[model samples]
Target: MKKIEFYKYHGLGNDFLIIDLMKKRPAVPDYNKLAEKICNRSFGVGADGILVLTKSRRADCCIDLFNSDGSWAEKSGNGLRIVAAYFHSNYARKKKLAFEINDEIADAEIIKSGSKGFSIKVSLGKPDFETKRVPMKSNGKFHINAPIEIEKTKFPVTVLSVGNPHTVLFVDRFDFDWKELGKIIEHSKYFPHRTNVEFVNIVSRSKVVLNDWERGAGATGSSGTGAAAAVVAGVVNGYINRKVEVVFPAGSLYIDWSEKDDNIYLTGPVAFICKGEYLFDAE
Candidate 1:
């Protein structure tokens, strides 16, 4: 039996099982299969996804993110904050840290840490609005407020990439059947790589409420990138300001799309759930 130790953490109810590959490296050849097995809610440890933290040659460490269904993700905002909290509590002990995900590098700063939980601010890279960069099948134009039909209902959406593809729609209220819409749009042919979907309702120029359906994780309580993408979309469409407070089902996150650098900064709270070891046979 292979025994792998893990820690569980959550940022505004978006939970992840973090495995330190630098500590006790597993011999599994396929990490996708491993992620599927370990992220199973009933058969294994329940989590929205798994984050593999490993040593990096270019930065302080590296983050390998996998969805519950074992799909590889390019980046995860909340996952990075959780990893920063972990490093701050265990190894780094510093407020600022840098992490590499694939070829991209991001920085995180721990604002506060205590026995209760941790507050972290992560600098997500610039938002991409190009059609090709978002990987959306388009006519080479930015997809702001573009109409897409689902089940005979037309919805105007703004598509962008915040290190990941997102489809943002401004809604009047949260009473609509967003889950069904999210399911259909997430797998739409327009998005070749699929997309995380967000329905936003603007409360003011500096506040909005969001409902998120993550690409591979279904309808999650909150999504860091989803919030960032929603705010960026709002700013582009003249609905909200550059800085806004995004309210999710479980909690709220502060997002700032800086005019100076154009980088999106996300600040939220992270909770330490628990730590344990999982014993399983290698396939």
Candidate 2:
């Protein structure tokens, strides 16, 4: 049996387990299997996903993330914040840090810190609305407020990519079964690589409430990228401004779609829960 050390953190209620392979490390056979086994809520440490930290040349460090279902993820807003918190707690007290994911660098800065944890601001890159980039199967140029038929029901959705594919739907309220609908939309044929679903309700010009259905993690309490996607969709539709507060079931995440830079910035809080070791049977 091999013991793997892990640190747990959460942005709002969306949690992740981070394994630092920068220093003392273990030779594992499969990271996919490790993620699947360790993220099990019943049998292992419960989390929405896992972040593996390794040494990097392009940035301060590198991160490879996997969902609870053992699927690879391109990027995560909350996950990046969690990693920033972890690094600040142990490594350096510097306010700024850079992280590389799949050769992409995301710059992060610790805006606030206390005994609880830290609030970090990260650049999630630009929001792309092109259908070819979003990879949505469509003949049109963009999928802004386009109706997609599912089970004979047409749903007006705005699809885009913020490091990952997202389908945004603006609704009046959440009185119906959005989860069931989200599950169906996540596996919809229009999205070839699958997609995250966001049901957003506008509160004011600068605020909105969101319920997220992630592609691999289902309905989490909060999603950083989902929040960014909601704001981007709102801006494209002229329903909201460039900056918005995204409220979730647990807490809120602030998003700023900079008109000058054309990049989306996500700001939120991350808290350290605990740290422990997982016993894995290498045999």
Candidate 3:
């Protein structure tokens, strides 16, 4: 009945379906329903989330992110980088770009480009350690290395908001059931808004291995904001250096917590998966 054009992209293995609403300007009454239908792995163009690029007065463009389960996300590091790469390649063709999300402006720089894809570095604003801002039901204290009980297991967690809420845990190894633990903590009562989860295994001061379970999207290969959050948590707890390399199952991402500006920078690569049109019924 109705055909909608889409672009598929991935950073590491965190994939998304990009829709240029600025260009198409499709009249979809319900974006959440559309996102759920399009991001269904078994029935639709499967992806971790859907990124909608639209016009913005404050910046060059605006990014609206929706998780696969149709939940709105405040921000995403990998999603920003991927959108930056797309804009750099198609529209702006500049080394630096800016986008607005959730009423905040984020800047990105194109470091290098090749036939494979583009290397993008994005500014993830600053980390917010306020308990209420993180929306955690605490005693109005920063949750740094705090113990949270999940299924009779006491896990030390660090909670913060990098545009979105996140909970980071440091583990000695990956022997434990991280997936089950992540799910439990994600829906835990402590976090009013479900939070993204990261399990970190420190290798050195400058490197660590990360496994992520996103808020709305379950377990993913890599998470851009998750990596940034993990590094920030590590630095705040004196577990890792300011500049750290976060290794995921798919690839590695570099996070630099600039002491001078106090802003977190995320650098990674984005690959163009494919471009296609989806045929669906118009409502």
Candidate 4:
């Protein structure tokens, strides 16, 4: 296998492989095997997920992402920014393109430099609060301040789905074992699909500090969906006004969680780490 050009990027700390699959599809015999192989820092491409950039008819461009666990997702917020940077440098051609993502559409523009990273704004579709849509085993309205047990710790959580399943817990301060708890809650029985857990500390009406125990990836990760869920949870708890700023260890994400609209939007920066190529045929 030859060294295929690749870019390493991260949203907060959730890393990814931004591939330019624009011209022709790369030969991938087994996605599951490839995900485990390419995403490994020691043995593979080294990333939390793999994001492929392709042509789109409906939007600026398109992105298809896959988790290291071999799960293909509809969208990835952090990845959007990273992809935008790649498009600007290589694919953009100094012209904007409509970004079509996973059957959804969003506008991405070439960001002028000021910050270390460029930003991307993604339309997060409609925020669904129905328990069935959230995939929570509840009826009628969504679950807010709902009690869920993971291990011996109990935290009343808001069951919300942001294109993905999540359970948000509001806290006055941050504490408790995150490494142990995050993994435990991710596999908690209630979520069915297993969920991303957010323990939030309300900074103000419009700001929050979020620590996520993300599913599929792990503790040291950034979940754009988890941040959106925190905002939705904050609104339900009367802790947030409309918009939300979720502070992570790496940085923060600004989320628009307004009550007037049913959709949520997440704005963040993606950092380009490095570009590398891998020889896979030998493995």
Provide the overall lDDT of each model, using Cα atoms, as 2-decimal numbers: 0.91, 0.94, 0.92, 0.74
Predicted candidate 3 versus true structure: per-residue lDDT over 1-283, tens digit per residue: 5677889999999999998988778767766877888899999999999999999998989999999998999999999999998888789888999999999999999999889898899999999999899989988579999988887878889999999999999999999888988999999989989999999999999999999999999999899999999999999999889999999998899999999999999999999999998876645
lDDT of 2: 0.94
Q: Scored by Cα lDDT, where does model 4 land?
A: 0.74
Top candidate, metric lDDT = 2
Q: Taking the tens digit of each residue's C-alpha lDDT, what string does model 1 give over 174-214? A: 88789988989999989998999999999999999999999
Off by over 4 Å in 4: 1-3, 93-97, 109-111, 259-261, 281-283
Q: What is the C-alpha RMSD of each candidate to the true structure, in Å?
A: 1.1, 1.0, 1.1, 2.5
Give the poorly placed runs of model 3, Cα more than 4 Å off: none
Tens digits of per-residue lDDT for model 4, 1-283: 6445678878889888877777867786655556667887787778888877777766656787777776776666666766777777665455344577767775555444344876766556666778887777765477788777666767788887777788887777766676677788778777677777788898889788888876667765577877888888888778787687889998888888655766777788767789877666635
Give stretches of model 2 more than 4 Å off: none
Clashes of 1: 0
Q: What is the TM-score of each candidate against the true structure?
A: 0.97, 0.98, 0.98, 0.89
How would the candidate models be sorted by TM-score, starting from the highest?
2, 3, 1, 4
